[model samples]
Target: MRTFLTLFIALTLGLGWGLAARAEGFLGVYEDLPLAPGLTEVEGSGLSFDSPGGRIVEGYATGAVEAAEILKFYAATLPQLGWARDSDTLYRREAEVLKIDTEVDGGALAVHFTISPE
Candidate 1:
């Protein structure tokens, strides 16, 4: 069952390595920012930190999802997830991490993050 779930997610959401895959109960505990719907993680695009401060996820959106929509989703949702958006940077008060999203392609939003404990 675990293998199936992993395979399903890999096929459906690309090679993801987030909290959802490790601890379902923890959910967003590890992944401070959520990936937009239909976005699949590009292979070799996952990065994490030993300290609870940094993680980066890169992926492309499937279907006809536009970049604007994806940006809107993050703009609206990040705050609800305890992130403060100052210009293009997202600072998580609760997590102490900084996150920024950029477009690598027309439908791809690459989220770059780093831990800032201070």
Candidate 2:
């Protein structure tokens, strides 16, 4: 099953470092994406979402691009639809790395995420 995929930068900038970075649990076709504020996963398109979590566009990888670049893309596409940033959660571990969970106002399309080094 495809899981939340990370759009990495070590690979996006064409660094060719071949670092130990890898993409795992990258899922597509998110279903029942919550579009409301209180509820969750009501209705979603198998293709595009212009609501809250709807900002999550496919055909992109975090492990393949810089964080700044990924942010830029989201910034450009999200605001165009007036999707508001409800909250951004950060997950971290002891002596480990930091992971980020981005929440939006796509109603029930609640897309939660966190990333760590591999």
Candidate 3:
């Protein structure tokens, strides 16, 4: 029983730390944007500082969250982060484009987000 308790505690703490570390990578321009609840960053699904002109981030997140909620969340939040919304796309005042699309992929939702300067 004591051994089981120790293992459980270690697993719990390790999981929390892993989540935090995963979130820490999305700093700078991505600071205002947030990952959907219960979603973790997919490996090799992100690109940062790719060029002098743009950056791209794309990946799938597995969660029970609804697609509409994810869209609504960004629709409302991006403007607050200084990205102007025009229909389904967002644009920065400096001509950067933030495109987002989501669809059901297997048991998870595939999220594609790309931002590029025009």
* Most accurate candidate by lDDT: 3
Q: Write the per-residue lDDT of candidate 1 for residues 1-118, one digit (tens) a residue.
A: 4365435545433444442332112113233345566454444544544545433333322324555765666666556545677654556554465555555555545544444554
lDDT of 3 by residue, 31-71 (tens): 44456554555656566566666655444444556777667
How well is each residue in 1-118 modelled by candidate 2, as lDDT tens digits? 1122122332322453322122222234432111212222223423434443223332212232334433433333323222333332332222222223333443322343322331
Model 3: how far is 2 from its true place, Å?
A: 49
lDDT, residue 111, model 3: 69
The model with the greater lDDT, 2 or 3, is 3
Residue pairs in collision within model 3: none
Worst 10 residues of 3 by lDDT: 19-28
lDDT of each: 0.47, 0.29, 0.55
Q: So what's the TM-score on candidate 3?
A: 0.61
In candidate 1, list every pair of residues with a backbone clash.
53-115
Ranked by TM-score from best down, the candidates are 3, 1, 2
Off by over 4 Å in 2: 1-27, 31-61, 86-118
